[model samples]
Target: MTNERSLSQKWADFRATKAQLFWTGIGCAVATMVVGFTWGGWTTGGSAQLAAAQAGTTARQELAAAICVDRFNAGGDATAQLATLREMSTWERGKFIAGGGWVAMPEMMGKTDVAATSCAAQLVATPAPQAASTAAP
Candidate 1:
């Protein structure tokens, strides 16, 4: 009976130390996570997935814009179209390109908005090719 009582007393005395150790472990785990995520470049699964999706969207838009530029330049009246495109306001250029069906690639069917805007910017920035003079200098 006495031994049992002593064992119980020892357990009671050690309870505070046990609780402190548990809390310390929890705090260490939280701190490690914070440091890892903030400075160690650790990303959660959802964040990685979101980043991948954004990258794919950006790549698709870029490809569509490139194809749109090629199609625009291949047209018979590219100079005239470029003149008209330049005359429009910046905000209207995207809609103009979309309406012209420059971004109608099969893979880019429903995703023309970003591609149109990018194509318009590229077209406006690029200078039209000069026509060769027939008269020899």
Candidate 2:
């Protein structure tokens, strides 16, 4: 009978220890989650910065291409423009050109022709003086 009594007390103590450990684990998990949520703004900011950087790069590249295409359309010679674009390192060309591909990057979205036509029209309206000078001679 005494042995049975001692065995029961041991079981009770073991159960208490298990319960305490379980609650401790739960508390630690909750604390970690709170800290994660409170201090995780850097991730969001980093993503936004990365997105802005990609957009800026795309805008600059698109603008350059538009200017080149403008020059090409003006005189019907894209050789210089193509050469210039091609001379860029493969990585730069890929980053700047449409199909050469910066689009696949997670930070880069798609392209739009939002300003292309208007810009082309403006370029067409204003012709270079060199052509007129050559014709005069």
Q: Using TM-score as the measure, which candidate wins?
A: 1
Query: On residues 29-123, what C-alpha lDDT tens digit does candidate 1 reach at each position?
Result: 99999999999999999999999999998999999999999999999988999999999999999999999998887876678899999999999
Each candidate structure's TM-score, on Cα atoms with residue i matched to residue i, is 0.79, 0.29
Clashes in each model (backbone N, CA, C under 3 Å)?
A: 0, 0
Best by lDDT: 1
Which stretches of candidate 1 lie above 4 Å from their native place?
Answer: 1-21
TM-score, model 2 to reference: 0.29
Worst 10 residues of 2 by lDDT: 100-109
lDDT of 2 by residue, 22-99 (tens): 999999999887787688543467788998988987686466546645544554444443455545654444334344
Candidate 2, position 44, lDDT: 64
**Positional deviation of 134 in candidate 2, in angstroms?**
25
- Which residue pairs does candidate 2 place in steric collision? none
| Stretches > 4 Å off in candidate 2 | 1-43, 76-137
How far does residue 53 in candidate 1 sit from its true spot (Å)?
1.1
